[model samples]
Target: MGVVINQSIKNTIITYLGFGLGAINTLFLFTRFLSDEYFGLITYILSTANILMPLMAFGVNNTIIKFYSTFRTRQSQNTFLTLILFLPLVIIIPFGTIGYFAFDAISTWIANDNALVKEYVWLIYISAVIFAYFEVFYSWAKVQMQSVFGNFMKEVFHRLATMFLLFLLYLEVITVDELILLIVIMYVIRTCIMMVYAFSVKRPTLKFTKLAKLSDILKYTTLIIVAGSVANIILEIDKFMIGFYNILENVAYYSVAIYIASVVGVPSRAMHQITNPLTAKYLNERDKVSLKELYQKSSLNLFIISGFIYLLIVLNINELYKLIPEQFGSGILVVFLIGLAKLFDNLLGNNNSILFNSDYYRIVLIQGIFLAIISVLLNIYFIPHYGLNGAAYATFISVFLYNIIKVSFVYRKFGILPFSENTLKVSILIFISTMAFYFWDFSFYPIMNIGLKSLIIGLVYGGICYYFNLSEEITKLLNKILKRT
Candidate 1:
């Protein structure tokens, strides 16, 4: 338990360091340094690549994590590893071939009026290939509990490359077209780095072992592909639909808002990296005690952490948006909606990991498919009428309901719930803190004014948390820091 907690904490700190860099690059530098149209184009291209990745990878990444524990010997694991490593190419080839044939039509449809977008659509496709394969390689590291390297490479390295590209663009060393080209090249480099790290962690032998269960592996991979696509649609279709119904500038606003919302989920991501493999191994052994403990603790910890971050963001949102361009200030509603959705997601914690790795995972596929349908319908009905705000509303409602359904399903099947008196107390504390922080206005100068107010609010909030013992771990850490100071 100590090691698990420590490793999770370390991974989370590292992740946030990366996220801090990314937040600056995405929200501040990108908007300040580039035109909104160009920023929108960048986000839209990444979103498109995200939408395509699950299909291109054929869900082999997920299959790797779920099945890797079943092979007992190192040799068997290596063989199984090799199978997933190269298997996606079999499907990717056909998909890429089909994409090549219809490239112009699809490109025309997605970017109907934007010449810049049409020119860069193929770059995004090339990016999707790299992104998909790198994920497969990263999953190989994840199942072995080697997440820090992959997480660093993923959360840090990619953004660093983008930052350099932004600098190049700012200096006029790269034209808009060159910047777009560099984006594709960065993905290629990032993917290659991850592949190198994957082999360094555990070398996948090329020795062809006669495995009779190829059909079973393929079937599982196919099912997960359906499941993965459904999940991806729920997460991304809102952004795509927003771009479709509105314009690139709308996407720029929505993307910044989503970036704000995504910070709250960082804990969930860090915890999942550690817990997912554990859950898979535990479920295989039917270790209900440890599994249940992991689920509950994960939920409680994430809720506490996410609650703090959410409160901070909501309270300081007015000030934070002031740091960006005036056009982006309209994204406040989008931020609140998406932030609430992310909070709901964080509260579920390892519920996703437990379910996805369990024998009852097919239920996940069913729920995901249902959520995908709901998300698409909501986007269709709302985006035309409400624009980006409508997209946010649709996302909030769909994701909120999707998580609720998953929680209910897990409870019915496992008789485990991820809530307690402490959770309720934290919720109440969050509400009170947010309300108090909202009404108090402070005006100083520039962005430093925002930073100062945030510091004061955070200190007061920390005092309240410590006084009430909202989280023993947090309280203890704060006490230690205070004492040292």
Candidate 2:
């Protein structure tokens, strides 16, 4: 539990730091510097790439994580890891080649009336493969319980690289065509770097042993792909559908809204990086006490922290959107809806980690498939009417219900729920803080003076939480912070 807490802290710091940098890029640079159409194009490419990643990798990343601890010797572990790494190529190489040769035909079919997006469809497809391969390497590191560095590289480095590319495009040092190509190249570079560092951390050998049952591993690997595809569709089908149904500019608006909503889940993503392996380790040891403790505490702590962040975003959303263009400002409701969905996601805490590593993982596939269908149907029904907001609405409803199902499943299987008295207190505190922030006027001063207002609000919020002892875990954390100061 301590190790989980320690790792979660580091992961949270890195995740939020990455998000802070992204907020600047998204709200200021991307929204200000790029047209909404271009912004949508960039987001569409990435969203499309994310959707394709699990298909291309064949889900070996997760299969490796699940089975890594099962290997008895270091040599066997290396051999198993090596197999997972190369096995994807057997499928991806042939598929990628087919894609390359038939790129023009595929691009023509998907190309909408938007001429600019049509011109760049090929680049998006190429970037998708690059992003997929990086996960192949990243998952190898993750199973080793080495996630902070890789998470930093994946979440932070790519954004920083993209920011630099945008600057180059702005300066005319690179043509728009070149900038599109650079996106693919940057992902490829990050993957290469991860591959290099992976060897330094745990040098995997190409040695194959008859002792390692390749057929059994392949069975699990196949399950993971189906599961991964379902999960990806649940998260991303809306974006793809939005692109297909609405104008590229609408996709751009939805992207900004999703970006803002994504911040609510940063803490959850950071925690998942560490928690997955920890859950696996606990499951392997059959340590029910530790598992339940970690599960409950993680739920409470995450809610306390993430709920506060969600409140900040929801309350200050109008002001934050004001930092961008009026077109982006129209995404405020989208942010609120999706933000609430993500907050519901966070409240489940390590429920996902617990379920994913447990025997009932097959249920995840069922639930994911169900949610994916709902997400698609809702988007199709609503997007034509509401445009970008319709997509956001679909995502919010599907994701919120999806999380409830997952939490319920975890409770049914484990006889545990990721909530407690602390959870109730945190919810009340957030409600009060959000109402205060929303009604309190900082309008007397210029918008440039907003930072001071935000700081004051944060201080007051922190003070209330401190005095109330919102969560024992959080109170201890604040004490540690004060001592260090």
Which candidate leads in lDDT? 1
When summed lDDT is taken over every stretch of 10 residues in candidate 2, the lowest stretch is 441-450
Give lDDT tens digits, candidate 1, residues 241-348: 776653888888889999998898888888788788888888878899998888777887789888888987888888788778899888899889989888889888
Give per-residue CA lDDT, model 2, range 290-403, as digits (tens): 888888877877787788788777776766666677877678888888888888888988887787667788768777887888888998998998887888888888888888
RMSD of each: 1.8, 1.9
Off by over 4 Å in 1: 212-216, 472-485
Clashing pairs in 1: none
Q: Which stretches of model 2 miss by more than 4 angstroms? A: 211-213, 444-449
lDDT of each: 0.83, 0.79
TM values, all candidates: 0.95, 0.95
| Candidate 2: Cα lDDT at 222 | 75
* TM-score attained by model 1: 0.95
Error of 1 at 276 (Å): 1.2
